[model samples]
Target: MSPAGASLGATVLCVLAWAGLAAGDRVYIHPFHLLVYSKSSCERLEKPTAEPAPHPSLTPAPIQARAPPVDEEALWGQLVPAAQKLEDGDQARVAAVGMLLNFLGARLHKTRAEMRGRPGAAVLSPTAVFGTLASFYLGALDPTASRLQAFLGVPGEGQSCTSRLDGHKVLAALQTAQGLLVARGRAGGRARLLLSTVLGLFTVPGLRLKQPFVQGLARFAPVTLPRALDLATDPDLAAEKINRFMEAATGWDLGSPVMGLDPDSTLLFDAYIHFQAQMKGFSLLAGLRDFWVDNATSVPVPMLSSTGTFQHWSDTHSNLSVTRVPLSDNAWLLLIQPHRASDLPQAEALAFQYDLPMWTKNLSPRAIRLTVPQLALRDSYDVQDLLAQAKLPTLLGAGANLGGISDRELRVGQVLNSILFELKADEEEPPTESARQPAGPETLDVTLNSPFLFAIYEQDSTAVHFMGRVTNPLRGV
Candidate 1:
């Protein structure tokens, strides 16, 4: 134990500790490493592709102007029963589907956020988007089918037709994902959420689609209606007809009608989803509250407030705060806000560009007095437009093989997915003077008075059903 020996050992320990920290910092992996295409895949995608196999023809079910009402009880009964019968490798398939959904959802959200000079609130459903994509996969052939299988992160890339993943099975998994969200909301005999999704196929008159393709739509959505319309001859009128039909079918005035109908488009596919949730113990505060749209601009919007111990995380390095609120027993909402009001876009970019689900993993329980805007957001985007924005316009273009959907020359003009998300605090009588006690000093006050981002995810599967950026609560984009 000489002084020289002690000093040498201390110096060595310090160096080792510093080295450990440096190594830890350098051991970082990008979230999208596995999802993005490799150099070879990109090169292969650019090469000339083979033609599609001849599609079989079947008499489609009679076109109906109005789809029958969905029996919620029966629908859930069927979905849950099948979900319980989890086949071997089903977990992997479900996880793959969820990962793809999150990846696509992030890309679509970032695209929408940057589309305008000033980003507006945009809402999208990963479920509906995935369903729309799955529908296309159902009808795709050859290279297109294999390409889609890769894009969707599903197995079955063999050259033989038998190797293609079954669309029915994929769609059924999607329905089961939806089922988990809704079933968990209703787990405690409380109707916290009401979710309805429909698929509308508007085609040119006399266009014959495969019976299996039409029937397979039902496995994903409760209602699938095919109607003959002149989408090419009268784009405006066709848009009006679709708007009215969806309104009548879903009983929710989506606020805006369908737009941007392709003039030459023979088929227009629409997936409309309506989601409403009532937080169990939240209360609607009286009068309108000032929601800062920017540093200077403010708009009055209805606000909801609740106090509870919720999972919360604040990333000082990223200058953001995340709050998790229970939507149901197994589904929760993640609210991400920039610490600085003006940094919303940057915060959003950071959240989506890298790993978002990773943020959820860091959250721990904290007493919070949370106030958020009453969200009534409706957003619709053409999947084709999204594809184009993502630099793959020809993925579903005219040359693509969608022979499985129709027998004749088929061109998918538009695949639009519309989403409506409404969140409200349950109605309650005004609090009495004595009952309205102030929150304790230890309670963290988190108010979403500025632009922010959000997502709703399933617990077990980690499926992100919805993702959005709320720049303006009043806009409801």
Candidate 2:
């Protein structure tokens, strides 16, 4: 698979893979707190009993293209993804999730730099993008589908001999990760992280989308809408409707990008993700700290400080310091800051050198004091540009078989992945002043007062679910 394809597949798998890691029991490597997905680590859940069907491929959906969105509401369908009753213990699962995490970390850094990784935050969901490609894969045929499979990694018993992947099974793993989050109901003991994902399909009026493609979409979003849109006459209006649907579904006033759909449009696709995790256990510092965007520029913002037995380490080689702190049972935050005040840009450049898992694996722990800005990332970007950066610009442009989206010679419309990641401390109740103090005699003092990169990752899968840099905490919401 091309690097772009592999990166895209890893992104798709991340949807569920990142979320599922929250429930499993895993050991934290001291200093770095990197969680290795071992058999012993997954004792909380049983091994998957049986593999899903092999080569559960979708049929050619050459339905039609030049239709219009007649019944928008009725067009939406309910998605009932098969409940994951069995947990597959195959090593392939680990390898698949691990591959996705590494890809995600690389993409995160790349995107961050592209967006100017300072004075603002950049966020994107890998699995959400991956989900779109999977949908396209279903709509594609022979060579197209096969090529997509290479990027999406493997499906079913990935280790077993199989010419193709079961798209449903691969998507199911992501749902498995999402399942871990909701398993804890809100009443007795449940998390407050509001993580939601939704997918939308817009077709020209009166097109018969394949049941197989629709069924495949159900694996990712419970409600997959097949709407009638007049791309030829009113493409912008159609885009508006799609945006409104996304905002309504997510209960956030997040309108989507105004896409330049072809006037002779057949199909368009969009994915929405809304995630916010308010810090519950940590105490907020009483005053705002100065965040340096550069040696000359600074911004004042609230900060969070803590001292505890976190796995902390400094790499003199990279001139970077990293500390891991638990955000939730399912989420761990890796706080990274440069060792020298002048090495911020150099540290950003070094991100390309370390596959996060490998770089983190080498970290050893010690008691430390860490202070971070009260940060949140509301980041969005065009995947097309990102694809171009990956050196496969026209892969989704012309002659692409996005048939699973619609039966006709579908044109790839605006494919956008938007992410909303916000962090808040002392949500339910105020933390005591003592809770804000360091819990141990600190060995290292790492203060993120300048341009620094950080990620909230699922330890088990090592998936960097949320990644961004805070150069000015006062910038992005």
Candidate 3:
């Protein structure tokens, strides 16, 4: 996959601040986290001719305070209030997470662009990838540590504890935002959301890992476990064991057997995420719809459709249309489809730009009839290869000082991220699902009939949680 540009080629160390810093019981988080503050693109979409222009954003009326039911320990959620309002800490975390999200979005885009029209869907998690890097940050030294701290959206650094942002706080904030989305329906007098992140460290037998690294990982994943592997004796067996262990740990097979463990290495790092959301007011079309894989190719797919007041924006200059389709109470699946099927790569590249937040501008509320293919993506990626594709090969490539991970000489091996993303109404019919939203021909129809890009973002933090593209809807996830 091709990279963004030469700027993206900057060494990971340049982003690191190793000045007079040492490994400690601290993690720094940059405070200014928001990536897009204003619109700076083709044009500020004006009013639509066919109907009254939709509101710039679907900002609901003021929400009153109330005693909301939510899992405080694991999730930050409340009733009555909408997600637009952000707290100081949450805002900072949003910016830090946003940067990582942009990077990951670019990675997803490159992968799909490299293999266009592949018979599978692609997905990635912003927080999960960031968490893995956080583990690295936990073991970093001085200038590098400081650079990571700032990159992660932690601002101000000094000898004083007051100046540094807590790494645990940043990780917790991301987890909370994720939980808030998946668990939103349950808190709002509906059903529970199914989402979780897991981090694992598989090391060669008898290897000792740093306590701070182990403990810091807890902030990112609910279940942070470190296990043993024998890559030297039998690399293939070791790979099989690791794969089975992950499957058992996450309750889902990785599909592909874990391969290519560096026998000389003593440690392997992995992160797993499972994010699934059932649309509240959606129903699958009675029969499969014809989705065009290309101008000459079409396939049948089970499409989900809904009708509601949604935020809509269109860019004629770029020849793209976007709509904020509600996935969960605290999250919106921002769907971007090109006016022309061949324009997908261009639209995807544009989406990767740092100013993507501007793309949501000038959108107003409109009654929309939305239909999209169900996305069930379960995939794993080698972090090393991913970094290379992102044009920062050496970020985790050669000369990576992962000294913090172990007390003895160790070769890093198989840094894989297992991501699972699924969306649907529900398996069993509730009979009332269809009636949840008014459906008719009067609404503006926004159907994803061809290749498109989509991202799920937390409304409050404005942080993109998941992103990917689908070319053939009929392809199994």
Candidate 4:
């Protein structure tokens, strides 16, 4: 399969393949077995099985902090070819993962808005969040894994091994999806995108992590940093140490101190992503623009201006308009802005209710002079908190089976993922002569001067990679 086709197939298989096979006594299954279907596997599925045997708790292997994993290529090689046959009944499940991310993204923004008691800037990543959950799924066994698979929209087949979903396939699909984004960014000389992901794991002293589990993380994050610290001693000190380590590793000061540290917790997980996209069509405006934060208040922020024919749609029933702009050959930025009279929160609530993917499909080309604020946004939230918001707080609780990750009982304190999205106008070259045409009677001026919602989509799969709300352009830089 071509690289592009492989990415699309992988994205489509994320959820469907998870429901393919159940976990037997084995801890890890090669993603290849789950992705590539054969007559032999089908025949095995047809056979009846005796009573299921309980798998003993897996033994954790000791390894030093920042140790290089052995056989990295062998583990990652399974994700290649990327394309796999997706059953007809399971096709819809292909989009299940993306839709879940959309729902969570909406919830994430809503939660932030409620916390501040006002509209606020928030950014959530579908890829990072999905990958983080999938990584945990790799370490989860039986009931915990089943719960995760269900939440991820994987359908239950049966009680046999063939009925269980493979965590490796889910993770491999995540890698391909992310790879597609990176590959898209590299094409088209006029555009540039920088996306980097890092996973940070902090463990209590003498607590060992499974080597296989750590090795599997290579499917998504290129860098995995594991450190052992005295988390039970002083929460503040521990937080400081974690912050310093992450900052040094990623060169991003997360600003706020890490919160919700449990003294008795043995493990903490944090995933960080830095994403920046720049395209040639838009040019930075010389002066700041007034962005109304509310009916009466406004803030001055940097702005970018672009004039050309672009995909655009105005929702007649609702007080919002949708605009789609190409960031790369394989990606688009869809902007949803509310009318001047409507508040963003109400518009956001209404916007999420509509089929978001349809917005991209329904867009029509129109001549537009678009003005949007230069954005630099960041937000971090705990996965546990997100589950609580989803009313599944105990999904990762003490009783959860994470034996694949470690042998001893573990208290997982936090599962946090931080996202940073930066969109800047490329000013290296002037706009093409056609784009610089003087405003005419047919040109419509659309300015995102107020709080609005935005989503980044992978063109091939039409999957939402990132969803966010921009209340103030300068808030989370």
Candidate 5:
């Protein structure tokens, strides 16, 4: 117990403690390390040889700027003259066909751009392009066997075009284009439908004579044309029939919905066919049932308030009334904003809070309107006058949550569930003695489940437009 012995022991303890702290800090501060694979093998490893010298004619040329590709311009040049000829007899049909073709070409360009990691332009939405394409085919395009075979380049016995290089060339080009579209992952389902439909129209006996379109329109009325009767009444059945035709025509099972389709694959197939038909100036709606309208149902909601004063707050709001609409089992409370007071913060807040969650991934703003007073005197208005003048829809629709909200109060505005929490190794706990046990085949299992909210918002503003609760949220969200 001498004083010098005590001091020396204390100094040793302090040094060890400091060293441990430094190690802990280093662990926390360390940069992430990425493992890189070595190119060379251990056996017979050698440095790479220098690249072969360029040929005399292929020597490094001076850099020169080149004009951007003008594929669209060239396509238009070929199309305009053909369109003019078609217009001579059926001007409306020709115009419709031209629009469909334009849409198809645009879709093709968009798909190409997406494949090459380019941003898609907003000039044409995919739905509009596909819809228009569908319309053109149903409205203007003939389903004659000769025309169908010629357009698609499919060969048949006694088909003289198949024997020629020109026929083969066009057929190869069409197939190549179709293959490229089918490879795109986003639009597979629509593409599959389009391709199957086209093939059905072409190869199915008597379909080219317009019976299928007539049947399809009658069955699926308003969404599809009735030119082909067989396809109109039972579109899904028609799709199945088309599948059979494709199998017969190509000698391959193109696969059926009964067999599970990977969603990504389906999207690519759908996009391919849609783009192709569009390119050929086909109208999707001409013979198809109105999917959007047919699928929509009036959602129901509890009446929160029914004060007439609320409705008559603005002149625009005078006619506004509340109504409920269903969005799945979940009822949506849609408060249609009035035209004059549409920009009011209160209206926006109400819509964002209630409407967005129920209709997330489905509903979109139907319209937007603005009004400005010309005179300064007119601008100064009472609250009652302003409210009365508001033209927005006062109607509200309600729906069920559809597993969107948790019982627990979540972190305000936190859009994602399952927030990652790093439990750092305890700094102060003493290391435990190593325990050993008899070892054999062992199984380790882990399970995690947490309820949390997710929100979708405009990219620029952090304001949440849509919110939902994830029951089985994906990992690393």
Candidate 6:
């Protein structure tokens, strides 16, 4: 038989064997024996027996009683007023503000989890915390009033402070969850830091005392929302301000640039100066500004001096100048100074050389003396393309497939064989010179009806250099 035919036969036998195993314990009879039995006795094979079911009384019993349903409306009625009062009361009256905010945040998180298909939490936890804090600071809640009397089966003026206190408790839980999520990189860490800082400002009195320094530091905080949203959401602003204050107080700059300077570089002189100021309990803003000025004088090369020009001061002034050369789309070139005749010939032999794409001359030069014009970077994929790529099963399931495949059964060397067989028989070939050429790379689709069966043949082909199967030609087996 041909190789393909042999492969097909082998695949059929393997599949039948697999199917038999899948069917569980079963007797196999030879064709001759079956024929002899049929001829001697006109009786068919006996049917298999079924297992008996257990008695209802003997089965495991279910729980008898359940907890009573919570009265959500009554609970809400009790909680809302206290929450409002606590939010509207003076800061002095609401001493345990952190506990209150945290409680509300937790409740919000639980509400969010309950609403599985919803976009956000039923109660906006952050907003609730902000509102509660605002209410307390604004003096809406009075300490003399009975805030919990109406909700807990107690008869009074119907003001339930417990409800408001619950809101704060929920808020606290939500904040904890948020912290965990941010730490895991699920939520933005920077945003979380800012939020924490803002909350700290309200809870920590000493930080707010130095408002000007805090505000200055806040200016450098990452812009979470646009200017309009920033103004509308007071919590966001407060959070950013608090973040700035914390960073300043700790002598750490969260907004420091990541790429440019080496860790040991003198450019961090400003950071050192700020650290000294922080140690002495000086105002952060003034210290930072002074540090920058001092650093500019100390390390002139790294600092951008106010000379109305962008220039890097080198250690040695040579006749030859170093200029940046633009390479291709994603490359850069630095042209070193060419030595003069007075200098050693070795100096002209190129002080530094690095491998880069040879197509560096294609980029146009910018008019600025020492600056390169911004390159118009193009995205490799459009929105539709990105969405389609994201939806593909192959990329999503690659990890699972890798985990399941045994190295002994399937080696990387057999991948090419699998790919070749994976190509369908009816798949159109690449256009030749005689045929009308395709504008782009030709694409083909291969569908597998039974991928597991094909995988067995693929393993066989990898183990032994032979074509696997043609059991389902249309399915690319």
Task: Work out the TM-score per prediction.
Answer: 0.82, 0.73, 0.74, 0.79, 0.17, 0.16
Query: Candidate 6 regions off by >4 Å?
Result: 1-140, 143-158, 161-164, 186-247, 250-477
Best by TM-score: 1
Q: lDDT tens digits, residues 296-345, model 2?
A: 87888877766656777778888998887766665667777887667766
Models ranked on TM-score: 1, 4, 3, 2, 5, 6
- Please, what are the lDDT tens digits per residue for candidate 5 over residues 313-408? 122333222222221121121233223322332333233231232223333322111110000000000111111122101100011111111121
In angstroms, the error of model 5 at 28 is 70
- CA shift of 149, model 3, Å: 4.8
- TM accuracy, model 2: 0.73
Candidate 1 ranges beyond 4 A from true positions? 1-64, 69-88, 154-163, 187-190, 353-355, 427-438
Which residue ranges in model 3 land beyond 4 Å of their true spot? Answer: 1-120, 142-166, 187-192, 426-441, 474-477
Q: Please provide, for model 4 over 369-395, each residue's C-alpha lDDT reduced to its tens digit, 9 standing for 90 to 100.
A: 998888888888788776665556666
Q: How many collisions between residues are there in candidate 1?
A: 0
lDDT of each: 0.72, 0.57, 0.61, 0.67, 0.22, 0.21
RMSD of each: 11.4, 9.5, 14.9, 9.1, 32.7, 34.5
- On the 0 to 100 scale, the lDDT of residue 205 in model 2 is 64
Question: Can you write out model 6's per-residue Cα lDDT over 111-216, one digit (the tens) per residue?
Answer: 3333333221011222223332222212112221112111111122333322223322323322332222122111121111111121111221111122222222
lDDT of 6 at 290: 15
Candidate 3 deviation (Cα RMSD): 14.9
Candidate 2 vs 3: which has more lDDT:
3
Residue 236, candidate 2: C-alpha displacement in angstroms: 4.5
